[model samples]
Target: MASVTDLQYVALAVPDLAAEREFFGQTWGLTEVGEEDGMVYFAAEGMPHPYVIRLRRDDERKTDLVGFSAASREDVDALFEQVKAAGAKIIAEPGPVEGLAGDYGFRFFDPDGRAMEVVTGGAQRAHRTLGKGEAIPVGISHVVFHSPNHPALVEFYQRALGFRLSDWIGDFMGFLRCNSAHHRIAVLPGPPALNHIAFDVASVDELMRGLARMHESGIHLSWGPGRHTAGDNTFCYFITPNGNAVEYTSDLEHVDEATWVPTTYQPGPNTIDQWGTGRIITGNVPHAEMTPDKGLWQVPA
Candidate 1:
């Protein structure tokens, strides 16, 4: 199976370009790599990829598309053929994007109308390490999509793109990994939209520093600065200027694949907040009325 090498970049549409740009630049501290046409790209430290986040202005705020790098040119070709053979909604044939920096690829839509791209190359990194106390993310870690049918999306990812199952948060959610680091994409049972996009930081200290930047910008944490039992990563989530959820996370556990086992965790405090500091927000909770209050299930400090 020709699998994706890693997540490349995610393009999201925001209502206000200036506000979203400000939040990502000054608040998030991500380096402005470059701009093309009308979109701006934000570069992450330590990763050779050209950009991790792409922003476009639109009247409606929502996710635009998610890009994944294929293992090679041949892999791109193979996947393109497979997608076409399966009669998926083909946006473009496998080829080089005229103005884009990367290699040849194709674009398609998932069952829920989410745009997904698979390509071999577009841009290369300049090879730089993050400085001390820097809060800028290293790269995009993962994207969680809220789908109306979790089972169908999971099957599509596993059967169509070769994403391996990492774990499950009950029957309502599924985590799928392409090249380790727990999961690159997750699916949840709800309306189709971007749940949250997580970025990798250097350490817990750096994650806190990033949180501080958000605090300085008057953006409050919507969910956590606590650990999640599933990914085993410390997370802090906040609402973006366009109202989409974004997360700063560090220390995500990786799977060996050979020895890893997927388990279904019941919806509870341990599954939601392993360290017991985060509240159940509407971001990850579809039906809040059925969830217990934060006080009832919190682990004692």
Candidate 2:
């Protein structure tokens, strides 16, 4: 099994580049770094390149999840083998992206057709003007994936990628970690577009301030300005310029290698929000009416 050394950046095929840049820039303070072939990349000053969002052209099929940046090239080699062994489909073989820096990796699809990958060392970190955690703290923290086969997939990450299970928000969400930074990725039970990508913040107050900015700018809040019992992180969701969800979060439970117990089980949403996650109906979300079940599972991953 290969270890999931670290979480690389995620690549989402966005429809609009200008909109995403304005959304991410205004909401999270991301700066537009570079562009190529109708695709634009935005970055947080803290995280490195290829982590940027890739805007797709009209004729291209939209890509859902493209995971990137593992801890080691060796781990990548090992997981590449594991992915093959599991009978998962492979698209691009592992290698270097000709035009990008440090993005030496490959592409494949998750069970649901999500374009996932393992990459590293592409594009140097330019650091965004805005990062997770301000006075409330800041920076992009982690991503969560939805899977129907939780245990089977958990083994994939645990055995092949070496993600230590941090805790379980519910039977649906499994918080996994690679580094001391609480969690890099979360495995959730299937069907929605990945739950959302969270960007770290300094405090709940900062989250509020950031939310205020979003509100004033007409960016409707998605989920909350509340706290979750799982990691003890304060969270709020906003629609980013990319149509991708970004969370402004703070105060997650800090753990050391010693006390960090990888556990699981479904927790009630009430426990998920102790500080009170404000009312969140599908209406607040952009495509809510279409996804009455909280998600549209059939979207090509």
Candidate 3:
């Protein structure tokens, strides 16, 4: 079956581009790779996806794009056909991608109107294995979104992008996996907006060291520094300078595709945070105030 093999990048537009650039490049531990057409790109030290993040200046902070990767040009075309057949609004047909990534891809809006791209054959960068205690992201782990109609959106992802269900948090949150690191996308019921983007760190030690680094840098921790029951990942959440939520996570479970069964976990304090430290220490919960995304239904630049 044609499917997206992995998450490739997230493009964001922020009102304070300089602060966002500095925050992602310096504080968040991503390497600034290149800038083109007023957009800045950042790559993780441990991944060869060319770039993992793309940022640009805008009057309002909004998600610009979420990119995924396919194994080949054939898969890209196949996925494009599936997306079109599923009735998504197409932005561009499959073709050679513009700008630095350099690949064959297509663009479209998911059911909630967020822009997405699926590509293959991009330029790969030279990356190294990040050592323990490095306190930096290896690569993007997953992205969570808030959807007004969560079940239908989950179905859209499954039908259009060939994702499989991994688990659910009761009836409210759904985890979907493309290539078995448990989940690359999860959805919750709320307004149509992004909840957070997670980046994988080396280990629990790196997660803690990152907490200390964020504290010293004066960025407030939003929720976590604890473990989650679903993916069994340790998490620490923080808001970027432009109010975009991001997470540093470790120890995400990988599943065997041949024998995995999806579990619907009962939602509770301990289920969301197994360590019981998130609420006890930070006094913040996992839920956040969500409004419809400003960038929704708008064509990307």
Highest TM-score: give the candidate number: 3
- Candidate ranking (lDDT, best to worst): 3, 1, 2
Candidate 2 has an lDDT of: 0.63
Residue 210 shift from truth in candidate 1, angstroms: 1.3
Whole-structure CA lDDT of model 1: 0.78
Regions of model 2 farther than 4 Å from truth: 57-62, 101-103, 126-137, 280-301
Give the per-residue lDDT digits (tens) of candidate 1, residues 23-62.
8877887778888888888878778777888888877676
- lDDT string for model 2 (51-124, tens) is 44444433322344456567666767777887777767787777765545365666676555566767766655
The TM-score measured for candidate 2 stands at: 0.81
List per-prediction Cα lDDT, in the order shown: 0.78, 0.63, 0.92
> Against the hidden reference, what TM-scores do the models get?
0.90, 0.81, 0.98
Q: Give lDDT tens digits, candidate 3, residues 140-161.
A: 9999999999999999999899
* Per-model RMSD to reference: 7.6, 4.3, 0.9
Q: Candidates 1 and 3: which is better by lDDT?
A: 3
Query: With candidate 2 superimposed using the best TM-score fit, by how many Å does residue 82's alpha carbon deviate from the native?
Result: 2.5
Task: Write out the backbone clash pairs for model 3.
Answer: none
lDDT (0-100) at residue 135 of candidate 1? 84
Arrange candidates, best TM-score first.
3, 1, 2
